[model samples]
Target: VFIGLGVPLYQGYGLTETSPVVSVNTVEHNIPSSIGRPLQGVEVKIGESDELLVKGDSVMMGYWQDDEATRRVINDDGWLHTGDKARIEDGFIFITGRLKDIIVMANGEKVAPVDMEHAILEETLFEQVLVVGEARPHLAALAVLNQKEWEKFAADNNFQDAEKHSEQVEQAILERISDALHEFPGYAQIYQLGIVDEPWTVENDLLTSTLKMRRNKIQDTYQDLIESLYKK
Candidate 1:
């Protein structure tokens, strides 16, 4: 839309602790789908667990009178942990997911569900998806189906119960998910799935004000369903 309107738009990345501005794309060196390069005096690097770390003059000294909290984020070396998973390719930083949001499997494999969820959502059959597998054997997902797309899929597949769960429907959904995540590592594949009829929204407290998933709350609400997946 911006391109059609002849308006140049760029995406940037930053945090409040870094005085709000960290990296931005300039007119001369703009790259799509990247947070651009770090500012002149702002140093950025990928720390442990792929977390983005920052250090420079723009970084804050410490939290207001909260030494412990400040120390937890900013190390003795003055590298402030940004709490975001990212990668730098050709000087452009691309955020993958949040470090705190990473799902560590029982086998010690760390999976970033954000990228997987985005991949599954591209199928258009799913309206929302949350990948969950913390300390379990494998990965599983809870998803809300797109009603219009589900109706069409059910009709085409000759499914009798369109709105509810069935072995056949579950298999079909899993197949779609598998296809969506084909490029990902084998361990990152979701082994089981739970379908939900309701959509998550800020009003229901399943989503934050910025429309981000409230993972803990959603898991709590669907604890039984998630547990059943593991049992099976």
Candidate 2:
């Protein structure tokens, strides 16, 4: 839509620690999905667990008056850990998720809930979704339904009750989720789900000022529902 309106919008990737500019797409070489190639004199490489690492003159020396904190991010070789999981293809960068948000299952399998949540949210019936399976057997999700979409779906299906957690509703949602995650690995599939009508927002304390999910707080607030998913 931006391009149709003659607006040349570009996407870029960076962090304050790296002087705030890492990669950017230009009009001459733009890949809508990628964050573009690293800037001149900037070196980027994937470190352990697919974390994006940077080493350049723009990289900060260290955190102010926080040697221990600085040491934790920047290695002896001067590579600053970006804390974002990413992949580089043909010199373009694609951010996948945050390393700090990875969920580790009981069997030691690591799953990035951000990617899974994004996939599930594409169904339109769901307004918000949080995938959780930390130290559990399989992945599960707590989702908030889009009321308009849910009502339409319920009417079309000839359901007398539009109960959020009804067996029929759960089965329908699971099927949609399966289709959305078909490209993902078997381990990434959601085995159980919990439905909620309320949406998480900054006013509700479930989201941060930056609009990022407060995962711990959300989990704690829905502890009973989450535990029931596991119990099933």
- Tell me, by TM-score, which candidate is best: 1
- Candidate 1 per-residue lDDT, tens place, 1-232, comes to 8867998888898889999888999899998678999999999999999989999999999999999999999999999999999999988999888988999999999999999999999999999999999999999999999988988898998887644598678988899999999999999999998998889999999999999999999999999999999999
lDDT of 1 at 11: 86
Compared with the true structure, all predictions reach lDDT values of 0.93, 0.92
lDDT for position 203 in model 2: 99
Error of 2 at 196 (Å): 0.8
Mark the regions of model 2 whose C-alpha exceeds 4 Å error after superposition: none
Error of 2 at 53 (Å): 0.2
lDDT of 2: 0.92
Q: What digit string (tens of lDDT, one per residue) describes model 2 on residues 108-156?
A: 9999999999988899988999999999989999998898988887898
Look at candidate 1 and give me any clashing residue pairs.
none
Evaluated at residue 156, the lDDT of candidate 1 is 90
Clashes of each: 0, 0
Off by over 4 Å in 1: none
Instruction: Output the TM-score of candidate 1.
Output: 0.95
